[model samples]
Target: MIESILPSYVVSEDLFEDPPDTMLFPEEEKAVEVAVDKRRREFTTARLCARRAMARLGLPPVPVVPGPRGEPGWPSGIVGSMTHCTGYRAAVLGRSARVATIGIDAEPNEVLTQGVLEVISLPAERERLRELARRSEGVCWERLLFSAKESVYKAWFPLTGLWLDFEEADLSIGPDDGTFSARLLVPGPVVDGSEVTAFSGRWLVRDGLILTAIVLPAPATTAGSPPGASPGSELIGS
Candidate 1:
């Protein structure tokens, strides 16, 4: 499902499993020893998926530890993201030379928990979701919106190293096109030496899963050059 939106050079991998108790690297194994069995499985599986993606890029399959904020600590020169929900796990990766940073998320197609929507959405976002739900009968617009926000934050945090409030991004979702645009409500973060005020991403609802992805390109070597002229790549799903 994710292969369509990503650029050809990016790698997107997925697994649905009760992951085995694979021995993790020292740091990662120690960190997860305290987690419940289920949490441990999810975390281990996500890391395994990440390692495989990186290995495909001709990089070593090293241990992916957690950063200070619990984001995956990828190998040097790799920019990537990971996400997992019940029965679903995925990881996306691109060489830092091809993509500056990337974020991907997957969620079961379902409604947000009661009152959760009210907390995460802006007034305008809620209104937009209603219009979208009216137009697209099958999608859970609330959940799609939430997933988009999660993708946005995933892409945002690596660059900013700061928290983005749920209401901080104003999203305009086009259900018909499976695309979305998020305009930063706060001063946007500086990425690769440029201030990014907005982000464009793609989303799809398929086989009971809602997936979304966002990629930030490395700044162009020259102002007018094309995306791939820089050192990085972006992800898209089929």
Candidate 2:
């Protein structure tokens, strides 16, 4: 059975338990493939875990179909996203009536190299990470930033149906009520003309696994839009 870790998020590790039998595909298989074994495995595992979690939530499982520009499309009535890395797999689900966007990500705690961090982080965000590192020694600030960026992508794409670059959104992380809170510095017409929104949320590490969830307010409704066409989108950035 799938397990619910938060009100709108759930997790499963079945993918880590049993890797997919890629050998089943013929050697001459012409399907597109990624050479990174670890990433392929993680993606496979994450999808399996998400399917099981959806079942536990009493929601019909939705096949994650990639839309134009690589965004995932969910079955009707639910807004959600998934992420998996190394040994972790997770999923987030939101009811259409309650939330317009939901994003979740899981990653292992490890030191991220300075070079890698620089590539993914904005200057202001790097400064905040420096402060956070000074206060909390050994925290994986770079990884968290990377994951948060990924989550933002997952959450944003479906709403705008547009691709966002890693530098488009800025993120800040700090201690809050015994957990970490992330605030997003998002700009442009995509955010409904708002310059920034505090996408507040929390994270926890349990048994060597780190899980984070961020829920944004449902976007304002338009005069003549489809029932599920809100301005908000959900994502997983790990």
Candidate 3:
């Protein structure tokens, strides 16, 4: 899949593979968990791949943990997010100083459908997909839209410490300076100084996978001290 560097983040994808025995123990399993072993393996592989990507940029490996509502907990001084789907995995890492949050998503070409597309996309977005379909045969525009939406969610949640519905964000994708640029249209006070905050980044397709990367502006406060939080307020990792 695509492995490319953006201004502030690195985006890459890998074919899903089974994790080595060293990564898991037999005792920590159940029947359902065993049934989803392939997903577990892919997630493990994605984490390793993400670490390698960060190292390439001379950043220290940040430990990741599951925060409230299942968002990733990046180590102090860094922020990042990851996403994976069947047969593919992707990760994004960014320097905390430059970006407050970063997210990447990848999808296989076949998992998206027209019906599924209708549910997640707006009318204008659907029209754009139709246009892309008309101009380029066999490209999975729906899947790309879904992946872009997902990437936006991952990037937005952490900084705002709030959950947003998929409909809350609008996306525009186009060619920019030799790479695909994605623009985000976010609703509500989540974004700084406006109801809609826009972010732009690049994406590409490689090896039958669609890869996307986005960099989010950092919050003004530190991890435990989110903006607008009064003293002793509960900390939520959005």
Give the top-scoring candidate (TM-score). 1
lDDT of each structure?
Answer: 0.78, 0.56, 0.57
Task: Report lDDT (Cα) of residue 172, candidate 1.
Answer: 81
Q: How do the residues 7-65 of candidate 3 rate in per-residue lDDT, one tens digit apiece? A: 42334435465447524223223212654666566656666666666776676665454
Candidate 1 deviant stretches above 4 angstroms: 221-238
**Model 3 regions more than 4 Å off:** 8-16, 19-35, 53-63, 175-196, 217-238
Off by over 4 Å in 2: 1-5, 8-16, 19-40, 176-196, 217-238
Better of 2 and 3 by lDDT: 3
TM of each candidate vs. truth: 0.90, 0.70, 0.73
User: To one decimal, what is the Cα RMSD in angstroms of model 3 from the true structure?
Assistant: 7.7
Error of 3 at 85 (Å): 2.4
Q: For candidate 2, write residues 9-97 as lDDT tens digits.
A: 33333344545553322321222274366655655556666666678668665566555565446678777777666666666665665
Cα error of candidate 2 at position 164, Å? 2.7
TM-score of 3: 0.73
